[model samples]
Structure formats: C-alpha cells, structure tokens
Target: MNEIIRLEHVSMAFRMDLNRTTSLKEWMVTLLKGQHRHKDFFALNDVSFSVQRGDVVGLIGHNGSGKSTVLKIISGIYKPTQGKVTVDGHIAPMLELGSGFDYELSGDKNIFLNGAILGFNEKFLQEKHDEIVAFSELDDFINMPLKTYSSGMLMRLAFSIATIIEPEILIVDEILSVGDAHFQKKSRERMRQLMEGGTTVLFVSHDITEIRKMCSSVLWLDHGKIQMYGDAVAVCDAYQAAMI
Candidate 1:
C-alpha cells in the first residue's frame, strides 16, 4: 500500500503568556519590567499515524481534543512543534467556514483567488470555473460581493471550489454541517465521486453516524492523544459508548 500521509511522534505546543499586553506600549513596558511569563499547552502529544492511498479516515474527539490541530498539520497550515509530518500528495482542505475568503470581493473573483491559493493556475481555474459555479448553484449571486452571502452560501461556494479539482488528499474539518440538508447530500455525493477516483480523505466530524457511514477507519483523539484507531464502526462505537 502507498502511504499518502504520515505523522510520527507529532507534538504541538502553544505558549500562553501570563500577561497579554495588547498594545505595543504595554508590551514594551512589560518587557522593560521583566514580567512576561508564559505556560505551554500541548495540543497534540506523540501522535503517530499513517494513511494509505484511497483510505477514508475519520477523526473523532471532543471539542479540545486537538482534532483541528491534526488537520492543520496535515494541511501544512502549521508546522509540528516536534516530530514529523509527511504528505505525499496535494491537499485540498476545507476547514472552518469562511476561511480563505475575501468578504469584500465578489464571489466570482474569490473563486479565482482561492483557486490560486490551492495552486491552480488561471487557465485551469477558468476551465473548471463553470463546473464549480454549477455545482454551487450560485449562478445568480456569483458576481455579488461575498459579504452579502449567508453562511450556507459561503460554504457552498467554498465546497464547490475545493472539490472542483480532484486532489490526492482531501482534508475536511467539521465542514459537513454547514449547508442545508439538500446541499449536504449533494456534497456527500461529490465526495463519494472523489473517492471513486481514488482520493484519500481525512475527515473530522462530531457526527458519529456520518463517520461510520463514510469512513473506513477512525482515529479517536482524547486529551491530545490517540485513544484508539482502527475500523470505523469499532472505534466510533467505543468512543460513543464512552461518552454515554
């Protein structure tokens, strides 16, 4: 099997300063007074995992269980403070809603910008532009500024653009809950299509049913560490039972 993603002994630490000086003046005063102090918080601890090509993996955990941190590391948005992350393919990450979006720009223009951010050339984006708009069902509002869009509309556009080009790896973090039921169904169908094309997907969702239905494997993270990882049904069942 080909390994598409690997995290070996990954650990992430964030420093929380005791005194948060908002202004430069306050910061300078604190520096001069030598009162700055910070405590470290590890979001992930010695995490190790490897994803093979064509695997659909789900990440399940509590709100502060570091699921988002894992996804960010995989997306190359943040470097691991310790250990290593190896990604063998291009990643299309649909993280928090409204990320990488310019509210002041028209939806059409933002599409190009987002495409560029995803490493797509203008020629390629132009070629896939119609398909993206068609899938998003935002033909009438495509030229309008994104600031006027609702959360659902914004997600629709983002999802469409992210899925337009098939990526080797797709990273989704709590994004399946954004749109209406119909749109969510459409998006799932698109994801299934991508899977048919051999895309490896790493997904994070609170919905255990969705995870079981869509994922082949599950990694349950708790307290910044992997609690269990294996078959989706077994891991999710264990996690769900533990919660009850």
Candidate 2:
C-alpha cells in the first residue's frame, strides 16, 4: 500500500506563561521586576509514524498523552515545534464537533459554511446538500438556528457535512461517542462503509473495544511518546496488559 501520511521525528511544544497577571500594566510591572517567566511544555517528543493508504489506525492514550496533538499536527492545526510531517491527498478531519460552525446561523447555512471549511466549493456543496441533510436525519431542523440544537444535533450536522464528500483521509477524534446509541451505530456503519470504499482512517479514542473493532493497527502513546506501534490486536493487548 502507498503511504498516505508520515511524521518524522515530530515534536510539539507549547509556551506556558508563569505570570498570572491579566492586564498589560501588571504584566509589564512583573516583567520589569524580573518576575515574568515562561516555560515550554513538550507534547510530543521525537514521535514518528506512517499510515498507508486504506489503513484503519487507532491512536489510544490517556488524557494529555498527546493523541489529539498528533491529529492536530496531521490536520495542520498546529505546526510541530520541531520535526517534519507529510500528508498526501484531501483530508476530512472531524477533530472536534461543531468546529467551523456558527451557532447563530441556521443549520442549512452551517452546511455550506462547514462544507467550505472542508474545502468544497459552493456549487458542490449545493449539489450534495440534500444528501447531507438526508444522511443527518435532521430534515425538520435544517432551517433552525444551530444555537437551538442539542449537542447530538450539532454533531449530526457536522458529521453529515464532513462525510458528504468522502475524503481520501478521514481523521476522527472521539466524535463517534457523541450521539445516541442508534445514531452512533449508524455513524459507525457509515465510517465502515467509507473505509471499505478505500478511505484511510486514523482515529483517537479511549474505547478499546471500538479501537479493536475498527482498526487494523494501533499506536499507543504515553507521556508524549510511542509506547507501542503495531497490529491492532497485539498492540492493544500489550497496552491492556500494561494498564493492568
């Protein structure tokens, strides 16, 4: 299989301010008094991984272990402080629910808004609009303002738009756990269909059952480093063993 994504010696660092002052004057005073300081927190350290075309990979780790950071780096949300990341083909990243949505706008408007954010042209979104709505099963609420919608409704809208045009690479981060059980089941089926149609999927989830069922390979991260990277069953089993 051809490689779809690669990260080489990737490291991400975030700046943290030591000063607690909120105002510019206070901040300046602290700086002048030599009280201001800052530190860098590395989220990923020398991390490297690759995903082949049509691979279903799961990223599993505890909170703050940098699973989401890896996704963001791949999605170009955050540039690595050091190292290299390469991606080929169009990407549909459902990294967060309701992202790129204007809550004040109607759901129909958000369809186009999110579609644009997903890199689709207006005409293409218009053509796929009906199908997206149908898939969302939110026909009655499509014209309502998004602020009036529930979390599940919002996720439904976002998921529908994101999947209207199947992207070459699909990146999901705990989004499948949002909706009701039925909707979640439906969403998983849709994801499976997308994978079957040759879309590469790399997802981050704490649910080991979902990871095992959906992924062929697993990447386990701990303390901002790779703990394991290999076949899903083997890696997951090892991770579970370590957790216990």
Candidate 3:
C-alpha cells in the first residue's frame, strides 16, 4: 500500500492571552518583570499517524480534542510546532464551508478563487465548472454575490467546488451537518465515489454512525491524545464504551 500522509510526532501550541485589557501601569509592571502576558495551550500533543492510499479514516473526539487541528495540519492550514507532516500527494481540505469565499464577489468569481486555493489551475476548474454548478443546483443564483446566498446554498456551492476535482487526499471536518437531508445524501454519495476511486480521506466528525458507515479504520482522540486506533468497529465500540 502506498502512503499518502505521514505525521511524525506532530505538536502544536498557541499562546493565549488571559487578560483582554491591561492598564498602562500593569503593562509597565509586567515589562519590568520581563514577562509576556500569555499562557501556552497545547492543541495537539505528539500525535503521529500515517494514512495509506484508498484509506478512509475517521477521527472521532469530543470538542477541543484536537480532531480539527489534525485535519488543519494535514491540509497545510496549520504548521506543527514539533515534528514533521509529509503529504505525498495532492490534498483537498473541506474543513470550513466557504472558507476561501469572498462574500462580496459573485458566486462565479468565488468559484475560480476557491478552486485555485484548493490547488486547481484555471484551465482545470474551467473543465469542471459546469459539473460543479449543476451539482450545487445554484444555476439561477450563480451570478449573484455569495453574500446573498442562504447558508445551505453556500454549503452546497462550497462542497461542490471543493470535491469536483479529485485529489489524492481529502480532509473533511463535520461539514456534512451543514446541508439539508437531500444534499447531505448527495455529499455522502460523492464521498463514497471518491473513496472507491482510490482517494484517501481523513474524516473528522462527532457522528459515530457516519464514521462507522464510511470509514475502514478509526482513530479516537481524547484531550490531544490517541485513545484508540484500529478497525472501525473496534475503535468505535471502545470509544462508546469509554463514554458510558
């Protein structure tokens, strides 16, 4: 099996400010003490994993368990403070809906901009433009500014554009909760198609059923640590047992 992604002891930390406001006198006092006003929050702690081609891996964790952080690191949106992240192929991250979208721009314009951000060249997107628009079902509003779109419409457009061009690795983060039932089914089918076509998927979601149904393997993360990693059913069962 070919490896698509490798995370070697990756860790990420952020400096968080405890106090929102500081008086001049307080700031001067802190300066005299030679101290900055922040505390370190470790988001990901020495996490390591490898994904192989055609693997559909589910990441299950509670809020603040570093699930999204792992996706961001794989997508190149966040850099690790400690080890290395090596992606051997093209990656498409569907972490945030309409993340690269410019609300002020027309949907058509945002399509090109967002596609480029996803690593598609102009020629490549042009070839898939009609398919994306059709899948989004936004033909009537395609010329309108994206700010005018409803949340569902925005999600449809974003998902359509993001998945139109296949990548070697696809990273998704609980985004299936955004659209309506019909659209959600369509999105799931599209993801299945991508997986069948040999794309590696890194899926992060709180929906255990979805994870079990879609993933071949599972990783359970708790408080920035791996609680379980193995077959989908086994890991998912372990997670459920631990939660009870």
Q: What is the lDDT of candidate 1?
A: 0.90
lDDT by residue for model 1 over 16-115, one digit each (tens)?
8888778999899999999887788999999999999999999999999999999999999889999999999988877864477889999999999988
Cα lDDT of model 3 overall? 0.88
lDDT for 144 (candidate 3):
99
Quantify all predictions' global Cα lDDT against the true fold.
0.90, 0.90, 0.88
TM-score per candidate, chains pooled: 0.93, 0.94, 0.91
60 Cα displacement, candidate 3 (Å) = 0.8
lDDT for each residue of candidate 2 in 1-244, tens digit (9 for 90 to 100): 6899999999999888876778999988998999888898999999999999999999998899999999999999999999999999999988876679999999999998888887899999989989999988898899999999998899888888887778999999887765788888888888889988889998998999989998989999998999999999999999999989
Model 1 clash tally, residue pairs: 0
- Over 57-174, each residue of candidate 3 has an lDDT whose tens digit, in order, gives 9999899999888898888889898999999988887888688999999999999999988779999899999998999989879999998999999999999999997788888887
Between prediction 1 and prediction 3, the one with superior lDDT is 1
Clash counts for all predictions: 0, 0, 0
Highest-TM-score candidate? 2
**So what's the TM-score on candidate 2?**
0.94
